[model samples]
Target: MIENRNEFLSKIAKQLGRPQPTSRPERNFSFSPQHQVLANATQEELVDALVEQCKNIHTKAITTTTADLVATLKQVVTDYKATSVITSTDQRFADFGVLPLITEHWPQQEVATHQWQERCGQDNITFAERADVGIMVSEMTLAESGTAVLFSDKDKGRSISFLPQNSIILIPKSTIVPRMTQAATTISAMIERGEQVASCVNFITGPSNSADIEMILVVGVHGPIKMAYIIIEDQ
Candidate 1:
């Protein structure tokens, strides 16, 4: 079957009057002027654009200083009235001092962190499905489309981001880029460096929505109904 497929491909190439290329073609892959302009935007501009785009898509985008992150998170939790929360076990949450605050503020509320064995033992999927909110630290954010990039791993499980009623993503301002291309480039670099890339790299734009029936929009039918972004300025 493999030999037959190769022969068929060769015949098609011959019909096209060209040899099948054995190496990657060299070409200019630089961004256009408009894209370059966005790529060269200042940090403040990128953040502003990201927030604006997010809001336009009905996604809440909040900005806070590193010092006020904990306070801001408390405010968000209170505003949403989130009782049960699920989150990734990323160390950055601890480093930022947000995890302790969450535990302290919602002492009685069930807080589930992705732990391989423990998660499976406790049926983490069930917990996540019933969670009021799911929190995660975004690997990167794109300003042009207001997209948050998250890679699923043992610590950062896919369900924690998609199963809850609401999602709260913590994005460091430094990780915000101008466009998807920039975000893709960063991920490519990580792969080139022999990093263990996860099986799923989700690029979430906003809350899940579908307008297939009667032209009426339905949100969160397939995923989280509400999406919120907390941008940390001094990270």
Candidate 2:
């Protein structure tokens, strides 16, 4: 086990033929570009920014209250005309009243839905690839870029969002932040606290588009052709 940072710094210092400094330097910047971007914005402003950014990226964004979450979800499911759907085992689905919609309500509406299970193995990827829409809850959202931050694990298969033809992400209003800077700070804090960060942290902004050839654009080349975000006013 390592006792302290001295050994680590000493090795680097020795390589450079210098002694390791005993103290660290202080940051005395007059301003931080990261925080300055949306420093004075309120939650409402951030939400508005997120919605507008979604439109700019060709993603459908809807805002609704918790009471209407189920209805809004149903509408999105129907609008997407999803015959079969797959979702991660993320408990936010149930916590946000989405599990019953997929499990109980979807069947009533003749829509088949499956939740990812480790025991299912490759079955999860197969279903997700064939499914019409994939659904996930954003752990954090970047308003400036209209991006959804997802932490994928065993129960939360990354394919749930990648393989589907279309994607619909649920975003709680309270999770909305200024931009990626805030998102980075969140992950950094988690690391400093010795929390186990997932191996996969997906930052998705709109649908997949490729402009590789002749600078021309082709949507859905790598991922979903269509994407939507249902923002819940949970806070």
How far is each candidate from the true structure, as Cα RMSD in Å? 6.0, 7.8
lDDT over C-alpha atoms for residue 169 of model 2: 93
Evaluated at residue 228, the lDDT of candidate 1 is 93
**Tens-place lDDT digits, model 1, residues 124-164:** 77878888888899989999999999988766778887898
TM-score of each: 0.80, 0.86
Mind sharing the TM-score for model 2? 0.86
Backbone Cα, N, C clashes tallied per candidate: 0, 0
**Top-lDDT candidate index:** 2
Candidate 1 lands at a TM-score of 0.80
